[model samples]
Target: MRRYVFGRLGQVILTLLIYVTLVYFLLQAMPGDITMMYLSNPKIPQAAREELKKQLGLDQSLFMQYVSYMKNFFRGELGVSFSQYPKPVWDILMEKLPRTFVLFLTANVFSFYVGFVMGKVIAWRRGKVIDYAATVVGITFWTAFYPLLALVVIWIFAYNLKWLPLNQFIDPRLWSAAPFTANQVFGNMVYGAAIIGIGIFFIFYYLLRGLKPSRRSRAQAWALACALIAAVLFVAARKGMLIYIWDITRHMILPVFTLTLINFAGTMLLMRDSMLETVQEDYVMAARAKGLPDKVVRDRYAARTALLPTVTSLVLSLASSMSGGMVTETMFSWPGLGQTLFAAALSNDYPLATGALAFTGIFLLIAHFIADILYAVLDPRITYTGQSGV
Candidate 1:
């Protein structure tokens, strides 16, 4: 396990190193430097422009500048933003990271569980009316008009009806005061925790319940119920339940739904194919021929083996979450890294742009590495033979 983890980690570091180098050269190849954007505004004089360029190190050799940038990046110094004077690039990213994380993580969990279960159900009833209907609906919703559907919903509910806030993070009113009191911070944390707990419980409870031993296993049922209740109460104590529910539900609904819809078709189809194939495998046939219960054969032989492919795909889906749906974030006005990166690109803030790119590259590389590790764990038939696993 230690070797596997270290190998993957090494690969991630190397990938990031290559990505950073490529990004630096690519930025260098762009038409103009950050100063040009500011200079074109006509407000600042040429003298001021020259001074600003000097201050920002645009006057230095390209090699020297690149070296300096890399050094600072390694030290977690993302350099100053050309647009936002005196603000470090790292600081901006930190401010936006949490919103993106919450949105993406929620979407991933929803999509994976929903797709996984739906795929199993369809596989169990393959070639039937229900299976065909589900396939059609899933394909249409996921492929034909996922983005448009989300936009329409947001427009109708948030714009036309004015029922939801169109864009932005939490209500500004919540943090307008200077030097927030300890009570306020504590209250906010507690409220946030409670909402997250409640949302998770509601979403995953059915899936967990369905996995219970038997319909008459009241003890197992009660245990799950208690677990759910305890989680909700614990979250409520840390963050008031009312605030938690309001924010999580309001802000999360559209994004989560959109992400789940986008991923549903692919996941469902993959699961269906894998399960169907597994059901025909010689081992599965053997298990069925031995007079085992149908449920036991399906679950133990079919479902277990089918899950290998799904597990790989699921890992990739989870990694893709960090990209955080650019269009969706724009539509919802959710404050996240996607929007921040968009702004950086539009403004030609080289340091900020490259910093965001580096961050994204690092995140993707790490996620891929994790997926590779999971693949090895799930299938002992596969083996890695590299100083750094890929």
Candidate 2:
């Protein structure tokens, strides 16, 4: 395991090195330079333009520039943006990072958990109306384009029905006007405390079940504990913080809904297919022959075996999500890495654009590596064995 892990890490390093090098050279090969952006005014003197180019290090050889860029990257600097209002590229990107991350995290977790559960249940209940309904819905959403799906939801809920807000990341009126009252704060705390109580109950009674601990049960316990903590932080914020969070949540409803819809169908179908296949295996039939109940036969024997592909799908989906939901984010006008990347591209901010792309590549590679590690954990039959597949 250690040998495989170390080998994988070495490969990741080499991959990232090549990725960064390629992105830098590609951006360099693009027409125009930042000096031109700064010298947009026709009256700007030639000597001043030359001085600015020299200052921006545009006058340096490609090899030397690449060396300096790598050094800055190592030092946690992504260089400076050449926007009209110049600032550190990292600072601009960092400002929007959390929003993008939280958006993807919430959507991915929601879609995967709900879809997997629905898939398993429906698959277990195959040949029934529920199964047909779920399959049809999953296929429909899966076939639809993401942006088109988002627009449909927007038109139905936000445009025609008026059930949800549209576009803005926050309700400007509520945030800019009324603030959370003391009663609101206290009430939210009480609400949060109640959730925590429920979480603890589930963790002990439902999860422990007074038996030996298993990975699934332990994971449930931890998930509840983490959810409890997040609920507390989110719900118990003071007057000033509460309003902003509330507004954000309200606005996030549409975008989150759109993302969840996009992710739900494919995963659900995958799980359903995998479970259907696993149920017909010899071991599953043997479990049935051993007088195991239907639920036990399906869950412990079939679903457990079916989980491998679902887990791999989850790893890839989550890794890709870390790059930010560009289409969804764009449609919603959300301030996120996706939007920032678009802005940088339009304005010819090479450093920022390259940095964002590099970050995306790094995320994909790391996620792949993590997925490789997870395969062994999810299935005992999987082993490295210094093989070609991994």
Looking at model 2, residue 237 earns an lDDT score of 63
Tell me the tens digit of each residue's lDDT in model 1 across 1-390: 667678668778887878898998887787877778876688889998889889989999989998998888888888988888689888877666656666776787788778878888899889999899989988888775655787887788778998776656555564354254323443454455556566655554544435444546546555666776677657555654445445545767777877888887778889899999988899988988999788778876788678878877776776666664667688777767788778877777888878878877876776677677656655566677554444
What TM-score fits each model?
0.81, 0.80
Error of 1 at 19 (Å): 1.1
lDDT of each: 0.73, 0.77
Q: Per-residue lDDT of 233-308 in model 2, one digit per residue for the tens?
A: 7644633566555666677788878777777877788899999999889999999999978877877788878988
lDDT (Cα) of model 1: 0.73
- Runs off by more than 4 Å, candidate 2: 1-6, 38-40, 126-129, 174-235, 238-243, 319-324, 383-390
All-Cα superposition RMSD per candidate:
5.0, 5.7
Highest TM-score among the candidates is held by which one?
1
lDDT of 2 at 85: 46
